[model samples]
Target: MKSDERMRLMDLLHVLKKRYATKAYDATRRIPEETVNQLLEALRYSPSSVNAQPWHFIVADDEAGRQRVAKATPDIGSLAYNRPKVLQASHVVVLCARNELPESYLTEVLDKEQQDGRYVDSTARDGFAAARAGYVKQHLDAGDVMFWNQKQVYIAQGFLLLAAGLLGVDATPIEGFLPEALSEEFGLEEKGLTPLVMVSLGYHADSDANARLPKSRLARDVVFSKA
Candidate 1:
C-alpha cells in the first residue's frame, strides 16, 4: 500500500481503539434502525468454523417477551432485569446458534461440490477423506458429539459481541434469560432458530453504574507467557 493510504488507515485505527469504551444505555433510550443494520452487517463478515455459519439472531421488541426472558436467565448475574430493559430499548438483538446434525454436514458438502466449478486436487480430496475417517473413529463409539458442535457455535457468539462494540452502539451481553422458556415464548421453532444471548442496544444512560466502573483485566503474569 502507498504511504499516504497506510497513514490514513493508522489514524482510523487509533480513533477506533480510543473509542472502544463500554456504556450501558437504559431501556428508555431509543436506538435508530440504521445503527441496528450496521451492527448486523458487521456480524455478517465474521469468520466461522469451517464456514459452518450456524448462528441466527432474533430481535425481541415486545414487553411480554422481554419479561419472559428476564425471569428465565437469573443466573446470568447482577443485572437480573436486563432482558426486560433489552426489550424496551429501541431494539434487542438475540444471538442464537443452530444445532448441526452430523448427517447434514456431508449433505451440504456434496451439494456444494455439485454446484461449484472449482477443482480439488487429489491430495486435498484425500485430506478431507482422512478427516472424515478420523472423526468417525473418535465418535463412533460415543453416543453424541453435541459438545464439539457447541464449541464452534461459541465462535459465532464472540463475533456478535465484537460487532456490536465496533458499531458505536452500547450493548449488554445477556445470558441470564431462561433458554427453553424464551424459546417457547418467542415461537422460535416456528422460525427454525434457538436463543443464545440477548443483547440490548441504544444510547448510554447517565445513571448507569456499569458505565462508571474501570475496565477490569488480569495481569499478564497470569494471562500470558513467552516460550
Candidate 2:
C-alpha cells in the first residue's frame, strides 16, 4: 500500500480506538447543527437488505422529547442504568423499525428507485421488484419480518456511531430501555413503527470516569477467521 493510503487507514483505526460508550456527557454543550446533519445523512445512506429501508429516526434534541425518551429508563428496573446517560446527553436518537412491510410500502420503494433512474427500462424495474417481493415473502412466511427490520436498523446505528466518532462526537448506543414504553410515548405503533434502539450523543463530560479506562476487546485471532 502507498504511504498516504496507509496513513489514511491508520487515522480511521485511531478514531475507532478513541470512541467509547460514553457514560456521562456535558449537558451544557451541544453538537453543531452541521455535524448533526452529517450524522443524519450517514444514517440515511446506510445499506439495508433488498433496499427495504424500513427504518425511521426520531431525533430528540429538545428538552421535552429527550425527557420523553429518558422516561423509558425508569429508576427501579432493569433499564434504570441508562436513565442518566439519556438525560444528560444533548440528543437522543430513537431508532425505529417498521413492524410490517405491506405491499404498498414495497411498491413505494420500487417506485422511488425507478424515479431515481435505478432502472433502464420497465422490465428492469419489474425484475427488481419481483426479486424483492420473493425475499420479503420468505421472511413473512417465517414470521421474521419484524426481526429482519430490526436487523437493518442496527446497520444504520453502526453508521451513526462511526460517523459520530469520525466527527469527534461521543455517543452511547443503548438497548437497555423499555421499547414498548418508548413506542407508546411516541405514537410509533400507530405508524407501524417499533422502537428498536436508542443512541445518546454529545461531548463526554470532563469528569467522565469511563474516559480514563482502557478499551478491552477479544484478540483478533479469536474474532476473525479466514475461510
Q: Report lDDT (Cα) of residue 94, candidate 2.
A: 93
Q: Report lDDT (CA) for all predictions.
A: 0.60, 0.93
Minimal lDDT window, size 10, model 1 = 14-23
TM-score of 1: 0.67
Model 1 lDDT vs. the true structure?
A: 0.60
lDDT of 2 by residue, 1-227 (tens): 99999998999999888899998899899999999999999999999999999999999987888889988999887878899888889889999999999999999999999999999999999999999999999999999999999999999999999999999999999999988888789888899999988999999998899989888889999999999
Clash count, one per candidate: 4, 0
Tens-place lDDT digits, model 1, residues 198-217: 77666667766766665556
Which candidate ranks first by lDDT, i.e. highest? 2
Count: clashes, candidate 1: 4
Question: Which regions of candidate 2 deviate over 4 angstroms?
Answer: none
Model 1 regions more than 4 Å off? 1-24, 61-80, 105-144, 187-194
